[model samples]
Target chain A: MRLELQGVSHRYGDERAVEEVSLGVEAGELVGLLGPSGCGKTTLVQAIAGHVRPTAGRVLLRGEDVTDDPPETRSVGVVFQRSTLFPHMTVRENVAYGLTRQGTDRITACLDLVALDEQRAAYPAELSGGQRRRAELARALAPRPDILLLDEPLSALDRTLRDRLRDEIARIQRETGVTTLFVTHDQTDAMALADRLVILEAGRIAGVDRPRELYHSPPTRFVASFLGRSNSLTATVVGVDPPAVALGDTRVTTPELSGTEDLEPGATVTCHVRPEHIVLSNTGGATPADTGFPDSLRNAEEKLLTLAGEVTRVTDVGHHYDVTVQSETGTALLVETATAPPPPGASVTLGVARDSLTVFD
Target chain B: MNWTRDSRSGYSLERLLPVLLGGLVLVYFAVPFLAFFTRTGVDGVVSGLSTPEARRAIRNSLLTAPVSTAVATLLGVPLGYLLARSSFRGKRLVEAVVVLPLVVPPLVGGTMILTAVGRFTPVGSAAYSVGVPLTDSLVGVVLAQTFVAAPFVIVTARAGFGAVDERLEQASRSLGHGPLATFWHVSLPLAGRAILAGVVLTFARAIGEFGATRIVAYTPQTAPTRIGVEYRRAGIDAVVPLALALLVVTLVVLMTVLRLGQTPGVDPP
Candidate 1:
């Protein structure tokens, strides 16, 4: 079923927890609410679940308004961060609890769905963390809800288990074809599982787009920084084309912006360049003449920006070495190098790629 | 090394003082009860049990305590669940009022009941008009016992209801059960242990209730009031056998309750 939230706003006494938020989820779509702690993501999910009523808004389920409906009346299921399984009931009994209320037969269907059929007789306390989470999910899904709200379903597991359950949860959602809204602070999980990402900041939507689009072309600085690491540099605009910006004898281009109508000459602009795009080389190498400039001329015309500093540290982080390059500009730039990293106290030249720099006016 | 030994000695001595004092207090309390039991052998116990007044008192105590406990559970369980789960205006005030009897002395509670349901009051007059006397009757004893014991059930049941996770109830609700059905299937089952504990505690409190029953309904003598009356009329020897009998019965009930509390899977009701 389709779920739509229109002009949703909620206030807790004096604090405006959520404001004027609107979004929609089509059937079988798994959307994610990505935000840090206290960013009102939980409030938004709770509002949809009818646990918390919005001060001003309407929740539409399949074109029917259910804003004033109580939680029991609304056909929504919510799985909390902590697996709130009934401690008194066994796993099968817990799953059957919701079914019995619906006048459905108490079968092993739900237990088999979550792959907990073997442990159906186990109590919640006897089950492992992952088992309990699956049990909770099965319990929530037993009634065939129109919407499923998952509040950080994997936040309680360890790193390895979280990765395993993350895929399991996504698979379950896809197989069940439930309109699911998952909330989490972990960006990796959001990217891997959600069909669309809705990043919330300070109770407001920072950005909402497909996972890849939101990562590759963030609409706001907050979204860019929150999604992943990016090197931000301030530059002055000398000229602008459809996809390139000239900044003080340095021309940089990015695919993020297709046109530059918003830019003005000499206006200060911020540029974000991914670290992997920057190429570093030994400074004494001969430069190709025909491709760019003559070797002697290139050597004579020193690289406009060169930071000469001793490397304070080099950390081998699996695929890349994080080189701590301290420049005379008094700023420490963390440059990732796939090659042999310079040892501590060795001097190196830092080169930033022209095409990799993303200009934001 | 010397300082460590001295410190250890000091700590041991400090621990010993409380243990000694506690042991002494235990003996002080137990000596009278032990003496009573010793003086009243099996014959005296049997003789006490055979007495018409003693048998009547035992029957009254047994009959009224559970009846009052059941009454308390019937009224207190739902009230406790409501107080624990729902939030409305004046909820805190209502909670405080429900637990008010816990703070009042049993005799004072009985006095309040007497004032409210005396022969001259409207309720007393209505009962009298209906040929159903309350004062000095078994109903009065049960009412007085319930007044003193219902709060125990309410308090314990409230705690039990509070211990049940709200998410469980929410899950049940989402599964198509209404609020009341959810309570029956999810909330109440989870809180069963607490409810059972409350029943035991209320029953124990009712059986031991003396002051209230003595004030409101002295004719139908429960064990405590009967022991008191026997002591006042015939001195300590006459009351000793009856006191021992009451103590034994109470101890057996309390032990049974403790055993029930120890059983696993008896969650809050």
Candidate 2:
């Protein structure tokens, strides 16, 4: 592990800020600590940076115990959420500050990565918001630390600037191949920048996996709901014949249920599938492309498992329409489509892929 | 900007109130200087300035005030940073003690200094035993000046240090600079304007200081003290020219400091 936290817990007085959290980042990997505000991501980063000492556990950098080392000896590069550019110094001086070599212009070399070498002579006050952020990044990069920590670097930026900076960060990480930890509450930013996402909830690690895997096959209910729009159903197993569960209308069975260990007959389980996986249509379209009728049909013509539902609402979200389908038992689900969805009261079929359904016992 | 709105509704008696209040305050502040300059002719001012007593006092004030201010800065700046950045027990009490000189009258400060370091006291007796006298000396003036003016440095520098973003120091640390290096390279430079303002205020206040100096160093009369002595002997007319000269010198120092403080990067908070 390039940077590792082993059961690192921190407390301020009696309030437990961070619990027993353990995670590691491999060399040349970009891992994102994704969580909402007050989730202790910032405190964890501070502990890693040696600003806040952990009340319990050890911090290791490159397999060396650096738990007692101060930030200067730790040799970690950090880009705080706010641009902490030394406003009194020019961009060049700010970047050159970390380099101990005398009479060397390493400032230009670092600024080259952020593409702000041209603005090297400008003061921090003179630069735009994005320029300052880039300059700060350049300063942090100048020292060439093995581990880089970025705390919500793009949160303060506009969407367009964020996209640009996010891509720049990804490109820079690739070029440097430095083990990096990016902290952010925005899932999209984390998804765009990180090689792996560490989702945190209430100061504990909820899940850690590659971005796409976490989005699609979340192991926990929180992970599933948090990753994206989810349509979850609570049902009890009616029978183990082909592994079927009694949902609102029919005993829905998927081949993926075989992988479920505690999913015996009569077991209560929650099954969640993403909104995008669900297909809604009036006709009996049974395939992945064809959405079946909105009715409780146990046996379909194509032997496909379908659910009875009505189109409750259609919301236009710029590029697409979010079609919400509610089952007869008031279990609501969403389906996104580029085309307009059928109006409310129109019957639609909620399609589910065998692989998309994630059951939690 | 919007003339129609101003004519229709904005130009009311309420709007006239602020202007009237501001004009009255401005006139009140300006009237003394206006009268002083108008009363004293150029030749009379020059004649007053040409006096050996005036020259000596001016020279003494010029020599002593800056040294006092420098001493204040050297001691106060670090203390200010500590006050702003660090937490200690009874911090409120410490802060109050730091601002005590600012609140106390200059005469009271001089008397307080006398009580603590008078020839009869151990502090003064020890210094006297070392061949240095506390009262009726150039050093005495500086000591009195510093006591009254040091609070300005600490107050302004504290504010300046407080205004500096803590994240800047954190970033410096993450970039491998230690605490001292970070303070020198980032914190000090960022807080330069406020510290310079403090130093300037200290110098100005020190130069114009009188009641304390009169008690501590009556021999080496500063410009303000000299003006007081002249006012008693020959009345207001005798001291106005010297007062104008002192004011001109103060303005020059202020303008120079203002220019120096206005560096390219030192933007006002």
Query: What lDDT would each prediction earn against the true structure?
Result: 0.79, 0.85
Supply candidate 1's per-residue lDDT for B47. 81
Per-candidate fnat, comma-separated = 0.59, 0.84
Candidate 1 wrongly placed segments (more than 4 Å)? A101-106, A237-269, A281-310, A327-330, A359-361, B1-29, B251-269
- Candidate with maximal DockQ: 2
The superposed Cα distance between candidate 1 and the true structure at residue B221, in angstroms, equals 1.5
Residue A165 error, candidate 2, Å: 2.1
lDDT of each residue in A98-216, candidate 2, tens digit only: 88884255776778889998998888989988998889888888888989999999999999999999999999889888889999999999888889999998888999999998998
- Candidate 1 per-residue lDDT over residues A114-232, each given as its tens digit: 89989988878888999999999988888888989999999989999999999889889978899899999999999999999999988888889999998877777678778877767
Please give the DockQ score of every candidate, comma-separated: 0.50, 0.66
Q: Which pairs of residues collide in candidate 1?
A: B191-B268, B191-B269, B192-B268, B192-B269, B193-B266, B193-B267, B194-B268
